[model samples]
Target chain A: MTGQSPIVYPGRMSRWEPQARERLVRAAVELFDEHGYDSTTVVQIAQRAGLTKSTFFRHFPDKREVLFAGQDVLCELLAGGIDAAPDEATPLSAVAAGLEAAAGNFTPELHAIGPALRAVVESNSDLREREALKHHSFADAMTLALRRRGIADPAAGLAAWLGVLAFTDAYACWIDPACDQELTALLRLKLRELRAAISSLD
Target chain B: MTGQSPIVYPGRMSRWEPQARERLVRAAVELFDEHGYDSTTVVQIAQRAGLTKSTFFRHFPDKREVLFAGQDVLCELLAGGIDAAPDEATPLSAVAAGLEAAAGNFTPELHAIGPALRAVVESNSDLREREALKHHSFADAMTLALRRRGIADPAAGLAAWLGVLAFTDAYACWIDPACDQELTALLRLKLRELRAAISSLD
Candidate 1:
C-alpha cells in the first residue's frame, strides 16, 4: 500500500525534499496494496506520485525500499532507547523500552502501516526472507545493548531474539480483533506470559 | 542434505522397501547438492537413481518437496514422542523429549546433512521459506500435543517455536568447528542456559 501523503515539509525536514519522499512512499504503498507487490513497478509508482521516473529513483532506489524508508531511523531509535535504559534493567526491560519507543515512533498517521507492510512482505519470498534478516539484525543490535551491561553468554543472542519475537507477537495481537489491550500493555502482558511459560519449563 | 537411507528390516521391514526410498533420497540430495536446486532436474535425479522420471514423480510431487522427503515420518515421530512423555513432565521436558526424538531420527547416516541441507535451503528462496513453514507445522503439531495435555494457553505455540530455535541453534553450534560441545550435550546445555536466561529476567 502507498504510505502517507507527500507532505512538503518546510525547512529542516527538507533533507531529501519530504514531498518527493512522501509521494514515493505513498504511491508505493498504494500500488503494492492495490495491484500486489510483484505486479507493482517503480514507473507506476512514479506516475501515481506525479513525478518523473528520475524523481522517483532519486527518492528511492527501488519500489520495495520505498516501503522501508524509515527502517534505519527506527533501528537508531530502538538502539538508543535500549542503551538509555537503566544499567540494572533486565534484558526484556531494556527491549521493552526499545519496543515502546518504536511503537511511539509510528504516529497515529501510520496506524495502518502494519498490515499494509505485512501484506507486501508476505506476498514476496525475497521480502519475507529480508524480514527474517531484519529481525536478525535487530536481535544483534539488542545483544550489543545487553553486552554493554556486561551480560555475557551465547544465550544473550538467543534471549534477544526471543524477546523480539515476544514483542512482535504482542504487536500482532494488539492489532487483532481478539485482543482488547493497547500495544504497550499488550507487550508487557505478553512478556510476562512468555516469562511464565519459560520459567515453568524448569 | 538427504535424509537417512531406509532401514532394511530382516523380514518385517522388507515390505516397506527402504532401498527404494534410500535410492530416491540419495540421488535427490546428490543432485541438489552438486548441481544446485534450480539447475537440477527430476529426470537427472531419476537417472542417477537408476529409475525413470515418472518414478521420481511417484515419490515426490515437485522438486522442492524432495528436500522434505521424510517430513511426515519426522512429524509423526515428534508428536508421538511428545505425547508418550509422562503427564508429570514439565512443558519443557515434554518438548525436549520431542526434540531428542527428532535428533535421534536423524542419525549418523545423515551426519553430512546439516551444511548440505542448509546450503540448498539458503540458495533457494522457496526452500528457505519452506523451512519456516515446516517449523511452523511442527510447532502446530507440538501445540496440539500440549493442548491434549490440558495446557491452558496456546502460547505453547511461542514456546514450541522458541524450543525449536534452541534446538536448531545448538545443533548449528555443534556442527561448527569452533564449537567443542557434542551435539546431544549442546542441546541440553542450551536448554539449561535458556532456563537460566528466562529466570534471570524474573
Candidate 2:
C-alpha cells in the first residue's frame, strides 16, 4: 500500500543515518510478531523505535513498505550486475551474475531477521500477494536486463525465472538457524541442485 | 473479485448446458476487448449472451471471475495428474505429468484467444497482479500435491516452480500463429530446452 519514493531525507539527516530506517524495521517486525500486522500502527512502531511518527513516515509510507523496502535495492543490484557483466556473457550467465550481485545485500544481520519477516508475511494473504508481486517484479527486471544484453524472448524470461527460483530456495535454506552457510554459498548450492534436478527431469 | 463458489447451478438448467458459461465468457471477452475490463458490466455481458443477469451470477461471482475461471480447472487437473503418478516417479517427473494433464485443457480454440487474454491482462495492473497470484496459486497447489507423494520441502517447491515456468514459456510459443506446434509438444520441448539451459550454466 506504500507508494512513497525511496529518496533519502535531505538537510536534517546525514546520508549515514541508516539507523532510523533500520530501527523502524526492527520495531515493526517486533510489533508485527507480538500482535498481528493488522493490529499494529505507525505510532506504535515509531514509539518502539524511539522516534516520532513523522520520522517513520519519512522513511516508509506504510508498515507494508518496511518489509518490502529491500526489494528495490535488490532489484537495482541485480540490474546493475547484469549491465556490468562482460559483453560476451550468455543469458544464464548474465542472470547468475545479477543474482550473485543481489546476494551481497543479504548480510548476517538481515539473515537474522529473515524468519520473523517470513512469519509476518506468511500470516497475511495480502502480504503474501505483495511478496509474490515483488518476486515477479524482480524477475521482470532480470528479464529486461537480459534482453538488453541481446538475449531472445523465452531464454531471457526463462533464465530470469530460474534465477529467482534459485534465490528463493537459497534464502529459505540460509534463514534456517541450523544452516551456517552464507547466502552466496547457499545460492550457489541451490543453483547446482536446480541444475541437477532439471537434468534428471524426464 | 469473483467469490462465487463452484457449486452446480440449481434445477433451472441441466449440467450439460455448459453453453451458458461458455457464452458468458465469450461475451465478456468481447466486451473486455471492445471496452476496457473496468467499463464492462455483468448486465451487458448477460445481455450480449442472450441470458439474464441472474444466469451470469450463477456461473461467475463477478466480472473478474470470467477471466480467471480456467485456473481452478487447471489446478484440479495438475493435482489429479500428480496424485495419479506412479509411486516411483521422481518429483520433477510428477510435475511434468501434472503439467501435461493441464495442457489438455488448452484446446486450439483457447489458444486462439491467448493473445487477447494476454492483452487484457497486460493492460491493467490489477489484472497483472491477479495473474501473478494465479500463477503462485498453481505453484502452491503443485507443491502440496508433490508433498503428498513424500517429496522433500525445497525439492517439491522447486520442481513445481520449474514446471510452471515451462508451462508459461510453452504457452507463449503455442499461442503464436507462426508456431504450429501443439501445446503438449511445446511443453515437452520447453522442458527439454530448460534442462539444456540449466546444464549449460556454470
Candidate 3:
C-alpha cells in the first residue's frame, strides 16, 4: 500500500509535501515499508522528507513513535467529545459522542496507511506492546473524562472501556479491504453490539 | 514490606529462598525498593539473592521481568478454570471461575509486596507500559478461553474485557490494607457491579 504520491488529508493536510509532521509520517511509513521497520532509521526518514535529523528528533523521540503521532490529540478529541455531550445524556451516550469526536481522525489518508502500519507494528513485539499501551491510554483518557461528567467509579470506567473496545474493533474493520461502512457507522454498530453482548454475559 | 522473614506460601511456595524463580523475584523486589527500579541492576539482584548473574538470567530475561513472573502460568490457570466450569455456566460465571482459579497465586506474601510493587511500577513509565500490556495479556487469554467454550464474537470479547476489569479492580482493592475481603469475594463483587453498570450504560 506504500505509494510514491504524497498522502493527502481532506481537512488539514496539503497536496504534496504537507506540514513537517505529515512529511515525517509519510516518509517514515514509506521507508518502514520499503526497508523494513527495523532497518529504517530516523536519519533516513528525515532525509527522505528533506528534514534534518534534529528536526525529526524534535517531532518524535524515536523511530517507533513516528507511526504513533497524534496519540495525545486523539485522546483530547475523545475527552472533548464527552465533555461537549449534553448533561442529560447517558454515560454510554457520552461515550458514543466521544467516539464520534474521534471520528474526525479516521481520514481516508489514515485508511490508506492502515495496512502498512498494522504490518509494521505486528511484526515487532515492542511495537505490539506500544499499541497495547495505546489502547490503555485511550481508555484512561475517556474514563477520566466520564468521571468529570459526574459518572462514578466502575460505571464511568466501564463505559470508557466499552468506548475503547468499539473504537478499536471499528478501526480494524475500517482497515479491512472488504469493509464498506464508514468508520463512524462501524463504531456506532460495534458499540451497540457490545451493549447487547453484555446481557449475553449472564 | 521487605523483611527478614522468609515469605511463605500456603499452597506451593516454601518459607525461605523457595524456588529459583521466587528467590530471584524476592531479590529483585528488595533491590528495586531500596535502589529504585531505574538504579537497580540485574547483577545486583542476582548478587543479593546469593546467586550468579547467569542463574538470575536463567530465571528471568531481565530485571523488570522478575516482578512479572508467572504470567503464562496465570493465563493457564485462568483458562483451565474456565475449561473446568460446567458447560451450562454463563459467560460471566465461567469468568468468575477463571478468576477463582487464578486466586491461588495471591498468597499473603504477594499482598505484602503489593504496595511496594505499586510504588516501583508507578515511579517509572516503562514499568507502567509493561503493566498495561499485562492486562491485555490476561484479557486475551480469557477471551480465547471463552471462545473455546462456544461463546460468540463481541460477546466473548466483551465478557473477557469485563473479566479483566473486574480482576483489575478487585486486585487494587485486595492490595488496600484497609480492605478485609478475600480476593475471590472481591472479584465476584466487582464483576457483579460491572454487570449492573452495563444496564446503567443504556
Candidate 4:
C-alpha cells in the first residue's frame, strides 16, 4: 500500500515523514482503549487517523504493530549506547549506559500513555504474550551487546538480565501516577538497589 | 470412559491416585514427540496411556495444560522454600535458598526429559509465550515471598528477578549433554557469577 499525499514536505518532514505513522499509532491506541483490541479493525484506525488504509498498511502490517513499532528503535538505541560506552567501563556499567540512553527516549508524554497502553495489553492474552516476548528480545539484545564487549557467558547473560530487570522495574515505578521522580533517577535508584540486594546475599 | 483394572492397590492408590495422571503425561509427551504437537489429540494421548479421553480430561483440561501442569507445583515449591529460609537470611540469600530447593527437584530423569520438553516448547510460539508468562509468574511469586520477609520495593523485585534468571540459566546449562556439573552446582556458579558481575559495576 503506497500513497503520495498532497501536502508538500518541509525540511523536518523531508527526511522521513512520520506524521502518518504517528497518527495511526495514536488512533490505534485510542480506539483500542475505547473499544477492545479484538473489536477494533485496521480500517477503523486508518479512518480515525484521517489517513487512507494504504498509509496505515505502509507504516504497520496490522493493528498489533502500532503498539510494538518502537521495539526495534529501542533495541538499537540500547545497543548503540552500549557500543558507545567507554572502553574501560565494566559490562554492567555499559549496560547502564545503554539503559540510560533508552530511558532518555521515554519522555513524559510517553509515560502518560503507559497506563492506557498497559491496560490494553493486560486485557488481551495475546498482547500480554507478545509483550513478554518483546521484553525477552530486549534482554537478548543486551546480552549480545555485552558479548560484543568481550564479556563471557553467564556473566554477560546475567548482567543483561539484571539490566533488563532494572529497566522494567524502574519503568513500572516511573509510570505510576504518584511517581514524582524522573525516569533517569528511578533507573539509577533501581540499579543501586539491585547492587545492594546482591551484595547482601551471602 | 472410566475403567476398573484388575491390579490391586495400596492404601494411597485406593483413594485419589496420581498414577493415571503420570501415565497421561508420559503418553502425551511420547505422542507429542512422535507426532507434532498440533497433530496430537486428547483421544490419541488417552489411548496411548491405556486410558480414555474422559480420564485425560480428569487430569488435564487440555493438551496445553499437560505441558504447563508443573507450573503450579514449581511455584509452590519456590514459595515454600522462601518461607522456610532462616529468618535472618538476606533477601537475595533467601531467594538463593528458594532456588536451591527448587533445583533439588530437577532429578536426572527430569533433566533427561528437558531436551524433549524444550523441543516441544520451541516448536510452538504459543507454548514459548506461555513459558515466558510462567517465568514471570515465578518471579512474581518470589517477589511476594521476599516482601513477606520485610524486604523493600526494588530490592525485593530485583532479587526475585535475579533468582529466576539464575534458575533459568542454570537449567539451560544443566540440560546440555556437555554439562558435567550438577544442577545445584551450576545454580551456585550462576549466582556467584551474577554477584561478581554486579559487584564489578561502578
- In the range A77-124, model 2's lDDT, one tens digit per residue, is 988888889998877678778989999988776887889999999999
What lDDT is reached at residue B58 by model 2?
Answer: 77
The per-model lDDT (C-alpha) reads 0.70, 0.82, 0.87, 0.81
- Interface Cα RMSD of candidate 1: 3.4
Query: What's the distance in Å from true for residue A98, model 3?
Result: 0.4
lDDT of 3 at B32: 90
Compared with the true structure, what per-residue lDDT tens digits does model 1 show for residues B24-53?
677877888998888988888878878767
Q: Which is the leading candidate under DockQ?
A: 3
TM-score of chain A of each: 0.81, 0.90, 0.89, 0.89
Q: Which candidate is the best by lDDT?
A: 3
Docking class of 4: acceptable
lDDT of 4 by residue, B65-162 (tens): 78877787788888889999999988878888889888877767677777778889899988887888888888889999989998887677778877
Among incorrect, acceptable, medium and high, the docking class of model 1 is acceptable
Report the poorest 10 consecutive residues by lDDT, candidate 1 chain A: A8-17
Clash pairs, model 4 backbone:
none
Fnat per predicted structure, each in turn: 0.26, 0.31, 0.89, 0.62
Candidate 4 structure lDDT: 0.81
lDDT winner between candidates 3 and 4:
3
Better of 1 and 4 by DockQ: 4
- lDDT of model 4 at position A182: 93
Arranged by DockQ, best first? 3, 4, 2, 1
Model 3 residue B30 CA deviation in Å: 1.4
Q: Best candidate, TM-score-wise?
A: 3
